[model samples]
Target chain A: MTNENAITVKNLTKTFGDFTAVDAISFEVGKGEVFGFLGANGAGKTTAMKMLIGISKPTKGEANVAGFDVRTQAEDIKKSIGYMSQRFSLYNDLTIKENIVFFGGIYGLKKSVIKAKSKNLIDELGLHDEADKLVGSLPLGWKQKVSFSVALLHDPKIIFLDEPTGGVDPITRRQFWEMIYREANNGKTIFVTTHYMDEAEYCDRVSIMVAGKIEALDTPKNLKEKYKVDSMNKVFLKLARNIE
Target chain B: MSISIKNISKSYGKVKALTDISFDIKQGELFGLIGPDGAGKTTLFRILTTLLFPDKGEATVADYDIIKDYKDIRSHAGYMPGRFSLYQDLTVAENLTFFATIFGTTIEENYDLIKDIYMQIEPFKNRRAGKLSGGMKQKLALSCALIHKPKVLFLDEPTTGVDPVSRKEFWEMLKRLQKKDITILVSTPYMDEAELCDRIALITDGEILQVDTPQAIMQAFPKTIYKVRTSETYRLIKDLKTYPKTHSAYPFGEYLHFTSTDENLDPEELIHFLEQKKHTQIEVEKIDASIEDTFMELTHTREVNAHD
Candidate 1:
């Protein structure tokens, strides 16, 4: 295992009865690299991500995340990585400050550390005025931003974001990418999945999953040249049109 | 007009869902309401479809008053809510039949209307709606919505979380349906999809920002956009935002789309500024604004005006 690699997977596979969700996929992400994982709906990207995050065990193969064995040290891997998804990330009913405190505690941070971190997080987000307000009252963009900050409260080595900008406006979406870039610049490995093809171009490297296999994996520039396309959207359309 | 909304306002308790929303959709025109979540799209749709009444203002669907001719509007409008509202327990065929029957029509009566969309899901006709994949479920929902051959179709973010490929296919379907003389009013959070509509209304925070053809909106962009590229995107964006003349700087794909507050901004001066910052592999060129650029500018200016 290379010390510079944050995540390593080798011929990982997961099956349900007769259905093969993720088929013998192999990939490696280096530390501090922004990796974009993309696929069509039901293309096994979620299954592959679940295995990498140490929640769902692979039916066959070996994988490592954050210097821990995925199968054996699943609990440790969970503790070492941060995850935020569009569907479930924060408690809407809880105030912003309370949600931060609760997530900080869940990450096993000391009370004093949590208090200091929450203050910094609120100030950084310019949400000091809305700290005591329920998270549900905040706009969708603000909620997504706050949830992302909460995910980083523990300062995990690698963070996984699932469709973080699914329905965000163009400006907020770019702001979210800026946040991702800042985290990457600070030496944090970012694993992200998004349906936005333009966003796929923002990643250091991207892998496109088809059915249950990775059909293409390369930098956006290389992928564009290889596919003879001008933009990532065309590359995606050409790749996805193959099945139909 | 196929649908018309005048000063439509709706509020839930203290939160104004839709404020002074007004738009008109011509017969057989494919119109889009483009906005993010919580932008009052669904509330406006509900009012237009006669399912809910607006606190103030008047609307008509298929030339029938929304309030007085509610039953007529209900019959003339086909609504596909954002969330799949089909019966999960029923099979694909049964769900279509149920919708057809409720409209006092039969599948055979409107078979031609949904043939293109229905055929795609016919193979899974016996499968339960709950067991269908995301794409399949969308197709089924769309088919059910069209069972009664509505005059005006209201699709509320039908492709919200759908993949790019499926989203493309869905838009193609709408285009074909539009050719059948049905007025379509669809809403989507994706700015890119706005181009597919004959006309679009950019709505945000319960207010309509702009309404025009996608091309016109881009052409009307008030600032000269510059595509700035360099080795360090993050640093370039940070520096560009801090520049005194910076109007708006947002990351677009691999490069940053920057606009200067000074009209007739010189690219050479910007290049020289970056050169002074010790940046390499720099490229700066004037580029046309896109729909997204226009949308961001409108919302940004709106925020600034609100603060003032």
Candidate 2:
């Protein structure tokens, strides 16, 4: 069932002992939309993301990701979504081809499909020459691109990118965004997070979390207008001004 | 000069980390080494901080030779590495005290020096360093680095991955530190932060690309950039790249920054071409080059030069 909303959350929350990491929050992400999830560090964005991605249990509330309940169908949710983070994505010691095959197998793809997808990915990324080279030897930008491709190996309908282009060069950052746009155009719902406010403006909608609560949620244009700021950076600064 | 480097180079086996790096920081000047990951910023910082040695050439920090007087530099310089190096199990106040004792000084001795920054996190002084938020951790790290009141401060990517609000505050603290006659050498990946420094050196791929004030560097961009926007962003980038006269096209927030190979480029002609391609809501405006634009251009030129 391909519902209009790829993700629906109502009062989703997570707590640790006496500390409420993610307070009661609610939101929905539509299909084929780019949703920017932004917040200050330790603002509970990570805690909330963990619950939605099917790794951690929520302390309270309800969320459905890709038509699967987060609490009951976490395995199905994991199968329906692709995730790529800058810190942990691919094995550096493995060759590019090997990493591709390994990830494809993890995603339960067949051997023949893994072989064919690996070829197409290498050719598309122009990494044919480096396919046999250790992933650790590749440049940071190239590695990031390769990691993102591997995340999409199983062709998930929704993708989650956690700072995929962090600390990358300017040109490479733009190139990564271009890849994001191509995927979104292909009808994949993109849920991404980034410290770079420029990337925020590219999303169809954005939600800013502050102190374990969603402080603002709207399109970038509307958020800018509401905050009376010319840029998302200014809006963020304005909202996070009172943070401890 | 607070810090002087002459043709310093370093290689990690086959990989060259720094090549012919030369720069000098004035006393009390806030100097920035701006670059992305894999740049030689950290390598140079390590050399200056006396944590690592350069294979060729020499450097001096606070009038002490990096090689001959490495021990003296250790006491005279305060370095905050990119990675958080403080003991996570220790409380915020304990970490500060620990660093102060190591430097043969006390936090009470330099209370006036770090009052502004230290006070911001003093409320959580009893919290474990591991339990602090990202911003709080950074403040504790900085306070510990400054507990000795060293003559020179070297911060490597201090604001990397920090939110905009905290990053701005951190730079403001740096501006105040510069006024206290403490020479500040900071490195960052954010190009916008480069403008906050009195002078900046743009390094990439282990080589310095340009060294100048942010204003001067932007002035020498050598291209007329136009902010172009339309409905289909992805298509616009592809079509613009395929254009014969296009020099560069990259995303700049809500617009695609376009530059032409020819000096006398006409925006009207570009608009007409996009209209033919069925792009609606077309807007094209001439804009000044930003530090990011200049960086990409310089890196691209370096690649082209390498090809030759």
State each model's CA lDDT, in order: 0.93, 0.92
Supply candidate 1's per-residue lDDT for B100.
95
What is the alpha-carbon interface RMSD for each candidate?
0.8, 0.9
Docking class of 1: high
Task: Report the lDDT tens digits of candidate 2 across residue range B1-308.
Answer: 99999999999999999999998999999999999999988999999988898999999999999999999999999999999999999999899999999988889999999999999999999999998988898998998888898899999999998988889989999999999999999999898899999999999988999889999999998999999999888889989987889989999888999989998978899999899889999999999999999999999899989999
Model 1 lDDT tens row, A33-88: 99999999999999999999999999999899999999999999989999999999
Candidate 1 structure quality by residue, lDDT tens digits, B1-308: 99888999999999999999898889999999999998999999988888888999998889999999999988988999999889999999999999999999999999998999989889999999999999999999988898899999999999988889999999999999999999999999999999999999999989999999999999999999999999988899888877888999998888889999999878899999999888899999889998999999999999999999
- Cα lDDT tens digits for candidate 2, A1-244: 1359999999998989999999999999999999999998888888899999999999899999999999999999999999999999899999999999899989999999999999999999999899999999888899999999999999998999998888898888988999999999899999999999999998989999999999999999899999898999998988988555
* Per-candidate clashes, comma-separated: 0, 0
TM-score of 2: 0.98
